[model samples]
Target: MDIDAWWGIIGQARAAVGDRADDRDSPDDPLPGALVDVLAVLEPADIIDFYVKHIEVTDAAERYPLMWASFLIEGSVSGDGFMDFRDGLALLGRETFSRAVADPDSLADLPVVVRMSRDEGGWIGFEALSLPITDAYRRVRGETDTLRAAVEAAIDGMTRPERPGGGTWDPEDDDAMRLHLPRLAALFLD
Candidate 1:
């Protein structure tokens, strides 16, 4: 996607999250779901940085969202307490993030895909990473169309308006990943 497109998306996502927060019964309500939507469009490493900047959870289960985000980015869960690569993706594919999260465990298994790039020594790192959705996986048990529809529905589902008490919707939240576009473009030029 182009930078402008990403900016638009981030704005939408942030608005969605802020809106949800307003409706929350508690001030400290977990922001995982909406934040997940925002991170979904970003590279794994950037996702990690975002959480480090935003989350204050000291517990493992609470940290699952960040762990899962990292898993999606790096494709492996190496480190203290994280699942190995194959299992990590399987867990996410199976929608088991809420169940199999392990926090406080030192993450050991970094994705080989991410590890291989550390030698590049460039900020252009991971600009080419794309959200690798696949039809074959969606076809598991002949559910390709169903899965596609589900994904589309989820993306569409993010369009609800902000609740009365929700913070003002900032369009940048939905497409925060766009913040990296300049870096990505620079990578391309190199």
Candidate 2:
């Protein structure tokens, strides 16, 4: 699906959930429920397209600089940690996602980041954002993975790198981290 079409789904979910979309404190995520409600009305083809588009949109945010951003925020990038970080970024909505993808360092100035820095207990990974498609499929088709599996098999056919590559500085180098991510350094490192 096209980027606009994909974002349309996310927009609807965000709108439907209202404040729940950003409620990290809540143990229950109403976003996926809201997203499923939005998805249940769409044609079946569009649902498959939505899954592919979701992956593409999240992958597009997997830049090397953003990994360092993840490290700064989360203390380290564990297996699939960066993946989950990108999920959170996508959930932040189109403007924030676009800004962050274009300028990874700009994230330090965001209100959400500011809150995270202040609340050391806070983290920015929304793994649940990945749930709605499968949930919606099951909700619509009823207790069957066959359709979802076929769609995912087609998506998985195309290949990409395991992890994003290319960075001139090491995460261990405080000076370079500060120099490259000055604002984030002030927020998380300093």
State every prediction's TM-score relative to the real structure. 0.21, 0.89
RMSD of each: 19.7, 2.0
Which regions of candidate 1 deviate over 4 angstroms? 1-12, 26-31, 55-190
For residue 116, give model 2's deviation from the true position in Å: 1.3
- What would the per-residue lDDT of candidate 1 be over residues 1-190, giving only the tens digit for each residue? 4333433433454466664332122344333244345556655434333322221111223333444433333434433323233222221221232233332111223232223234322110111011212222222233335444544554454433222121222222323212322222122212
Number of the top-ranking candidate, with TM-score as the measure: 2
- Per-candidate clashes, comma-separated: 30, 0
lDDT of 2 by residue, 25-137 (tens): 45777776888888878866678778777777887776788888888877788658888888878877898789888777888866667878887444567774557787787
Measured on C-alpha atoms, candidate 1 has an lDDT of 0.31
lDDT of each: 0.31, 0.76
